[model samples]
Target: MQKDLIKELCLTQDLIDIAGTGTASQSSTSKWSKENDAQRAVSGKEFKDFAFHTDMETNPWWQVEFEMPVAVEYIIINNRKRSPFDERASELSIVAYDNEDNEKLLHSGTMYFGSEDRGCPLIIPLKGNVSLKKLRITLLKEDYLHLSNISFLISDPLRSFGDKPVFIANRGDGLGERLRALLNSMVLAKEFDGHFIFSWPLSFSKSEFHAIDNPENVFGRDFIDSYLVTRDVLNRCEIKDLRNTMDFISCDNDDYKKIGINLDQNSLKNQIKDKNLQPKNLISEYKLAFEKINFNEGVTEAINLAKSVQLKDKVLGIHLRTGDIVYSDYRYMDRYYNKVVPFYTVESLITRYLEMGYDIVLFSLDSSACRYFKDKYGVVISNDLIPEEYDDIQRAFFDIVLMSRCTEIVGGLSGFAILSSWIGGSKISTYKKILSEEEIKSSFTHSLSENGVLSSGFISPLLKSFSIAHYLQSFKDFSSIIERIELLKKCIEIDNGNNYYRLLLALDYYKEKNFSAADGILLEAVNSTDKSNIKWLAKTKFPKITILSIYTLELEKYASQGSIVAAYVAFLSRYYYDEIDMNIAFYKDFIQKQHNNKNSIDTEFLKEIQEKVNLKAENL
Candidate 1:
């Protein structure tokens, strides 16, 4: 009778005196004699019992309506017999009908049989709001010919209390892999109650951003809550020439007087005559406490691994990171693999070194790619010896470890790759098509001059260059793109058909508007035997239509400067005409609508050029 009580009812016991008419042989009339029938009274105090004379044709299902308003969060149905029906109960449906004659199907699922006739409970969240007075259950199938006891236990909703925080440990560069290991161990240690810390300089911001999206958006959100960062140890950073990028300020001078963070200790005491320290001082103390925690043992292992793998001269360590940060953008992909180095770039580089009679030990973060190379090219990969547990961390860690072990490293442009190059003291080589500082600063000016016709090829290469520059700035005295170019040249000498690298060189020439040089490199790349998809794009493919459009616009600027010859003007006009004609035809139906038009001026210019060519041809 209690609001949250487990009640059981037996239909046969409840309807003892009331008997249905049936044949003596078919019915259990004698089984319920007068005295026995009297004992089987259907009363509120007694459990209901039911006896069947014959199995019904329609599948037998019992439906119960809640007597009082109840908020049911879980439901359990116990089939009493060892075998309840001919087949197992396949489906269960819970439907609720409102007073207005509208029905809402609340929950539906398959029920699995468990021990103790305790048909596995189906946990449904009857979210805090809503009260239900009626409930119906439909059973699809059962194992036995008969049904037994059906009970309902109802109670209030359960709530979880506490702030779930995600811990992010800042271990600086070279500590990425170790930090990940530490966070992983801590998560396991904390019984996975909260999200573990993540090391920064992560593989990609897009990946990290996706990893920490809204609680309901990510798969692992239930385990993590908030982010954590370590204290800025000025002394350790001073040794490494590393500076903290995050600002940590103390409001009161006296707050960090012991740490020498504030110069005027007395100024804060006199400025705020409160009974206690100011909120700033309190916050500062909290920050200090948060940072001073001991390093996790897992992190210590990562540190040890970094120290153990020293850069010995003979070991040509190559750290290849294959995953892309901006995978969704076709332009970004083109910039990286086409304009930058593709997978074949590394493959060809290693092969070239192998041919040069130098023992090569290559390692990569992308194990799948590494395996493919080993099988296809017969190159010796070093990661085969790594422990399985060590391999369990994310691909970023795998790259860091490989880079730490290498003497000289080469790869596509990546922050993690750059960090590896810095920490390992390894000479680094990357795709040569990077933008200059002047080009980056004048990007806005160029964009305005081009009238919004921006080149993906130009933009992508510049963006990647800036990213690499920013990452390289962290390491002092070792920043030189020329050094990378030298390394790439050596690689080319060893490998005759390094088309990816050749393509990058061509892209660099293209960026400089050295069309002759670009065409020469691209022609060689197209003829090379390196039969990869990336190579194919760099060789035969013209600049992306968007890039061509921008290139023509830049030529128009040159023409406007009175520096363009007749040949130059004709080339620019032809390029613009070709791209505009293709784009216009592609979007002809859409562009017919006034609102769908894109760059009307460029369209009109292309039409004018076409008309002139037609008129000139008629006169000829």
Candidate 2:
């Protein structure tokens, strides 16, 4: 039977297990039993014992003999259970016998087990080689051991395999909303599979490591097959290097093969091409899209009504955007505006235009700002017909359509405002000055331009200073204004109503403020019927106030050009209280002269002026 069994084992190429029998109480039926006095016992010369266990006291001992003397470097003991043993294994020992048949112990140590011992079995190294034909068994506890099956696996020495690869997709949390959009493009590129692993920087505890010993916890049942105590490997160089290496590949390099990935470059290029192939890429597309959408019929009717009643030779479309510096912070809580319009910058820009003698048919996004402008600067706004809840994009589209009908545009440095100027086939003007690199790097809070306009590209001082100065000067030049307006009109007409001509117009207007008859002409160019919340002075009240203050001061010199004592006095009275000390005496003397000649001014107007002057003097 033994010979047949050996032949069967040889034929199957499987390891053979020797079972022992004992009495019922101290039964040899346990599969692993120390030899009885009656049973033949092999006196060991030199041998090693490898034990397999299911639990603490349930380990089964095994003895094996080789055909020839072979050196055993390591033993791989497989635990087939789904769970690991609760207690630690006692000992792994190598015993040798001298020529006198005396057993001598060589080496012994406790064997350690991992969290999931069943998944990763223990590998114990042997100290030395021993010559023996047979080995003896000593059964310890049997808590987790199954007496029915026992076997041993032996293998030669090999290098250890490194840890599993960990993949991370690192992106700023502020970009979370746009991540889906960006990922949409990425997914189409076929560079990455849908499966992704998220590794949060924070979310682990040391106590969680002990829970890994449980089969359900370690295996994660159906959820995950593998998990690591991340904190344990937190500072590990291998982990950091792997994460950094992957980040370089996925983000920085943008090269596929360098990071061991295969992708079709042609397909990716085609996808990018498709994005650029949007219908709105053409001028005809803009016209079609605009025409297809039936805009405010009421606004269009109002424009038609205004045109039929009285026509201005020129219509200037004004768009103002108030930006809050605090909103630039990436946190969600502070991203939105506290008010509808940013008043300070808008007011400043508007004041500049008013000084140039521009009749602004302002289209403001801030309703409150529009009222304020009308009350303060007497600027007529045309956006009251539009809805309040329209989002920035929708407002932009509406502004484009409205601006397309305008002769000139005055815009603030905002995406919405700029888009309006771009859409308005008109001469456009902006209030901001380009900064030099040195200027940008300075510590002043007001020096920084919005939306990265300063550092966008290399800009020459001549081009910048001249552009701003020219736009300011243009506001006072009729011929220059006409030329710029005509140039913008031509660009828009030739470019299928493209806004680039308008941007150029704005650039020129921004360079030189020529507030001439073209202001009325520019005002005539817009569709007054299109009402939007943007037309409200409340949207631009603060900026309107600020810009008006600046323009009023700048045009203070021009008020005397008329030499009407009453008009000059009126201008001085309106601006004197706000002017700095440098011009305070000039305004004060002009006011005194007007007051002395009471015949030139109406008695009521003079009394009101005197009252204001007295109030100012009292405050001082």
Candidate 3:
């Protein structure tokens, strides 16, 4: 009944690749060569190894008859060519047949492949209960059909849960912290009969603020097979770089409070429903997941260290972490903000537990905090628990084991503390700092301007530029329209090549009715708008938007690719000239259609623009 007891490996979920055993065939009347045979599709080799290719013929199709009927939830397809998007594969049709030849249309839709989906699975979820004996996929056009690989994820026990996929997306976080996401996902996978994928941080030493390695190196196989990286027995991230941009439903690692200007709050709410997902059953899940891993010499040594500590049954755990030093520059403070709960704040928990007579274990990254805890109540120091040299991962796992053994824990607002409590079956109280709306706006690591809008590490540089432009537009408290125009000019000065910022400046100028000023920037925005950047940069095709009545022909060509903000602004400009008018029904229909294509910045912009548009339309 001990919460922290290390038990044997528990295999709750089993994921296997059954595509290789199946028989594959293409159209018999086809004049394609033998080298481009259909068997290659079911070869089950890593992506880019080989593919089943077909000539540019009408309605090219490939079929595979499974060795046996199996219950499947997702079918992952990989295109031979990632970049320049295999447009032939864009509009695809899939059909499946049971043993009785009863057909079920598995999937029929258009899929967008961005740069993130490169060398990764284009996951397609099946609708309902599907037991397939044979499957066929068609290009649905007169185009060359080249497929690198096909995979089916079948879990009979977890059939009812369907396609609720989970992804362990830990970027630059520590082992113990990432494990919290991994373990929670494993628990959820079993609880809901689901499957999960992960991208492990490189085993290389952690750099100050930068990632340990570039994305290319970190996602490489060397890091995946590294001794330090924990591997899933059933489903490790074999198809690495698990980017969920294209995926509609998935759980990625994200701190709820850390969300910024461009994040989708509604989508985040759906992903992390904290009420149902607390680690009440984590201790058992941890024991089962790592039970098989104990045989590793390093793991055994860590376990022995945990046993050697031999702390009293009623042991108290105190977890603390210092993400960044309070440096003079304060650039690194964002990582630490809201994570640390002051010692004085949790002093009551420590004192109350001490009166109840429990042993104490202080596990911390902050040496000074450890000293304080040890000095105050004479707690067991896990930092000094390791006798001599320690592997970075082993040392962290040692901390994990020790913390899990505690009867209760007083810790900060981090996954490390929350997950440790789950593992030890210990009562944990996390002291989180509360921030006002204004404080939250300026909290993260950012370069704040005189107008007080912040831009920094919270968003990718590409998106940060877009989000900053959006914040500048929505800064209600500070700047006048003329003042806002000056800020956009300065922003454009700093990032001269940004078409997004240029287009935003045009929007502002138009609003001021400065047609000449708007027209000047409109020329710059048009000339700078590069479809190549859209096609190749992120392969996102996310068009830069503008509301100028004299919008360029090139801009009109890709206007559909722009966010709803573009649609509204353009429509309003037309409406002002009596060129077009919209009702509530038309506006709602537009939102419904353009909702999925929107990026985070679009979400933020849409919220502000939507409110203004809705209020104005109420009068109409």
Q: Write the per-residue lDDT of candidate 2 for residues 1-620, one digit (tens) a residue.
A: 22343235433532222212111111233344333311221121111221232223434444444321223333333323323332333344434333234554544565544222233434434432543223333334554332212222222111011121332222211111112222222232223322212211222212211101221221222222121112111221122222234444445353322221111212122323444322233333323322332324333443243334232546555664422221111111112222112233344555555666556666654445456556666767655544565433333344445655556665543334433333333555553342222332231112124422111233222222222323323333423655656544543443322222233353344345443432222222221232211122112234224212333443345334322222333334354434333454554555565655555333444455456555655666
Candidates sorted by lDDT, best first:
3, 1, 2
Give the lDDT of residue 459 in candidate 1: 28
Q: Top TM-score: which candidate number?
A: 3
TM-score per prediction, in order, is: 0.29, 0.23, 0.36
User: For model 1, how does the per-residue alpha-carbon lDDT over 71-160 read when each residue is reduced to its tens digit?
Assistant: 444443333234444134446566654433356787667655432223442334454234444555455443222223233322211101
Off by over 4 Å in 2: 1-313, 326-359, 363-365, 376-378, 388-401, 432-620
**lDDT values of the candidates?**
0.36, 0.34, 0.51
Task: Look at candidate 2 and tell me the lDDT of residue 151.
Answer: 23
lDDT of 2 at 299: 33
**Candidate 3 residue pairs that clash:** 10-288
Give the C-alpha lDDT of model 1. Answer: 0.36
Model 1 scores worst on lDDT over the 10 consecutive residues at 15-24
Stretches of candidate 3 exceeding 4 Å from the true structure: 1-172, 188-197, 208-283, 292-295, 323-335, 344-349, 432-620
Q: Which runs in model 1 stand beyond 4 Å of their true positions? A: 1-313, 325-348, 351-359, 365-378, 382-392, 427-552, 555-620
lDDT of 1 at 305: 60
By TM-score, the candidates rank as 3, 1, 2
TM-score of candidate 3 on Cα atoms, chains taken together: 0.36
